[model samples]
Target: MSESQNVIEIKDLDVRYGWGRHSVQVLHGVSLNVAAGCTVGVVGESGSGKSTLAKTLVGTLKPTRGTVMIDGVNVSSVRGADRLKLRRKVLQMIPQDPFSSLNPRHTIGQALAEALDPRHADVKKHRSVIAEWLERVKMPAEAMSRYPHEFSGGQRQRVAIARGLIPEPTVVIADEITSALDVSVQAEILSLIAGLRQELNLTMVFISHNLAVVRQVSDEVAVMYQGKVVEHSPTAELFNNPQHPYTQSLLRAVPGTPGFSIDPGITEHISHENRAIA
Candidate 1:
């Protein structure tokens, strides 16, 4: 949480697609840090570059400008084996929809084995570790042989998590990982992630639009608006005294059930719909 303890650092990051006449920037000089062994949440509304940031961290997207530093190395600049090594050992991603993320043709064991392959000299040697990761993520040993479509959404997510964990990476970037599941399943997955973070001493970059869910998992919260972070605070502080107008509005947009009296003051500085982003 301190400047000297950063495990991941992004400074003046700008991500864009194409170039010249077709260039469209998604991240506007974004910057943040994740301290070692800490969970940092990047929260924002839809189309706010949350997904782009997550993808950049996990090596799926390259920034048009700036750097993504992990363990003091500029990850965005690496190519081929160097980049592959960094991602397999230092970074991993838990995608949003587990149902779609997993390969339908491959069994759970096969999918997990692929993730562990980078560590193993031979893919065949990773079988035992695959079983262990499945157990760690709360999946039954028998479920390893089943295909993704055979399991429920929550179960598939557990398998997806197992795949991500099999590599024993230091940083896990979860992109709305539990957004598609039921509330009960969401809680289960979140608890599993929290437990894993503690047990493994792992650092996590959790990206989501759900403020309540982000509040539950993150030690620090970064409220992003229009592709730039507007506020960064300790989770408790952000929840208690949100300073940014967009952050306040997002909290209000969360639906309340019957018998709940929502505070109307949270929206005083925010528009009915945020219009600041292109």
Candidate 2:
């Protein structure tokens, strides 16, 4: 996509844990572009730097090198007041676990009210807006009266989604948002996200290890392996004709895929590929 059409543009991203010889590189020259109102699925196994990329987008983890531009603002350059503004308006994230993020001491109403307007004293003033959001997420309006602990995992996830979108952010990064839920709940959550994405024309980066789930949600998919993006293509094209060795191995290892299964050999293949890349 062209620069004007892309809402998020990442270029040659590099992330490291330390300095000098002790430095452990987590991401190596990663680049991705997300068009406005589109979902980009980032699929990779553990340690593929999926979460790291999510963090970089969310500003929780700073990039060691390269540029991250969201809505024309450079993420690394924004600081202090600008940084807070960036978080509230430019980007927001739905975390992997909702229970931990929600406050146990506050009612769902207060939590959402805070999200709506952090300094608004009258929580009741946000009642209508919060109710509308709750309805949008297919939750009961009365759910506002209950505490986070009173909700199930799926219900909590619904609340989390509401909270993330309540701010009307420019971009939302969903990092393993369904990993903690059961299979049925995962389906429900994914469906809800799809509906919401259409309704809001949301620009999102969905990080997941499940290729099937990615295929259902994403218009485009980027396959990550060993901190690098090995392949990026339309969802259908990537699944049907993966060009990278790591990506092909990942597809073949999908459960019930004729003759392949995930095992030590998968890592061996990756190792060989890594050597070849190096």
Candidate 3:
């Protein structure tokens, strides 16, 4: 996509945790571009830096080097009030664990209302708006009065989704939002996200470890290993012809693939391919 059509752009991003000698690099010279109205799946295993990337994009964590440009503003350069405003208006994140993310003390209505933009903070004035969003996420209007613990896992996630969209952000970063749910519930959540994306004209960055889930929802996919993006391409193309060894290994590791094996030679054979790609 053209630069003018891009909503998210990152270049040479590097992230390190801790100070001095104790520091460990988690992301290495990562780069990506997300076009407006497109869903890009960022796929990786545990500790592969997918969640770190999501945090960095949402301004919760700053990168050690490189730039994160969202809707023309450099995230790393913004400070204080500017950063707060950017997060509130431009981007929002739906975390993996809804039970932990939601405030147990707050009613569902209160939580959703708090997430609305300041201008819409008056719960009384925006009752219709809150109801609209709840309906959009397939929740009942009466759910507003209930507390988080009163609902099931899937219901809480639906509430979480409603909260994330309350502000009408341009970009939504969903970091493993469905991983905690059962397979049937996972399908329901994914279907909801797909429909919401179309109805709201949303741009999304979906972070997940499951290739099957990624393939189901993404228009494009970026495969990460260790701390680097090993492959990025249109979803179908990458699934059919992965150019990187790590990606191929991941595909082979998927359950039920014929002749799948934990062969040690696969890694040895792919080392040269890894070097070639690097």
Candidate 4:
């Protein structure tokens, strides 16, 4: 994809955690791009480095090697105050666990207000804007006065989405955003996000392990395994004609699709070369 068209450009990104013998590199030269106004769904089983990639984009975790450019700012190289500025203006991350990411001590209004202007997230002063955002996420405007513990799991997730988006950042990284909710609530939240995404023309990297969910929200899809992208293609094409063994198996694992259930015997033979898919 052309740089001019892409809001996110991640090239040869290598990320490692810990040090010395204990160190583990989770991403290996993984590269991908997200076009402006499009949502790219990233799917992988546990330990696939999906969350790690989200952190890299949101500027919380820097790439040990290679580069990550978000909305023309190179997150890998920017540091200190500059890094904070990038996070504040260029991008935001909606973490998987709303309870953990949201401050239990802070009221809903205080949280959303702070997202807009951390120093001035004064609920009293920014009530109008915060209320508007809460309503935009299908939440009641009065929710601002409530606490995180007062809301249901689904509602908290909505608040989380509002918080991430109120900044009006150039791009968003939604990491396993709906994994914890029940299927019914998950659908409702997805519908809410879909409407919001179009209204905002949002550019996002939506991370999920559920193939069905990815298919529902993504314009394009990237399949990761053992910290590498095995296949990256348009949503329809990837589902119809998966090329990688892991990807093919993944499609089979989905309900209502042909070859629906994976054969247990082949689970051990899913391949380990970690080769990049063409």
Find the 10 residues in a row with the least total lDDT in model 4.
269-278
Q: Rank the candidates by lDDT, best first.
A: 2, 3, 4, 1
lDDT tens digits, residue span 156-198, model 2: 9999999999999999999989877766677678778877999
lDDT of 1 by residue, 1-278 (tens): 47778989999999997879888899999989999999998888778899989888877889988999988888877889988888888888888888777878878877887788845434347667777888898787877778898888888888888888778887888898877776666767777787788889889999877776777789999988889999999999998888988778766663642212122322321222122211
Best candidate according to lDDT:
2
Q: Write the number of the candidate with greater lDDT, choosing between 1 and 3.
A: 3
Q: Lowest-lDDT window of 10 residues in candidate 3?
A: 258-267
Clashing pairs in 2: none
TM-score winner between candidates 2 and 4:
2
| Candidate maximizing TM-score | 2
Worst 10 residues of 2 by lDDT: 258-267
Residue clash pairs of candidate 3: none
- Per-residue lDDT of candidate 4, residues 171-234 (tens digit): 9889988878876677677777777888999999999887777777899999999999999999
TM agreement with the true structure for every prediction: 0.87, 0.91, 0.90, 0.89
Tens-place lDDT digits, model 3, residues 122-228: 66777898899999998999898889999999999999999998888889999988777876677677777877888888999999887777877799999988889
What ranges in model 3 sit over 4 Å off? 118-120, 256-278
What is the lDDT, from 0 to 100, of the residue 149 in candidate 1?
A: 88
Question: How are the candidates ranked when ordered by TM-score, highest leading?
Answer: 2, 3, 4, 1
Q: How many residue-pair clashes does candidate 1 contain?
A: 0
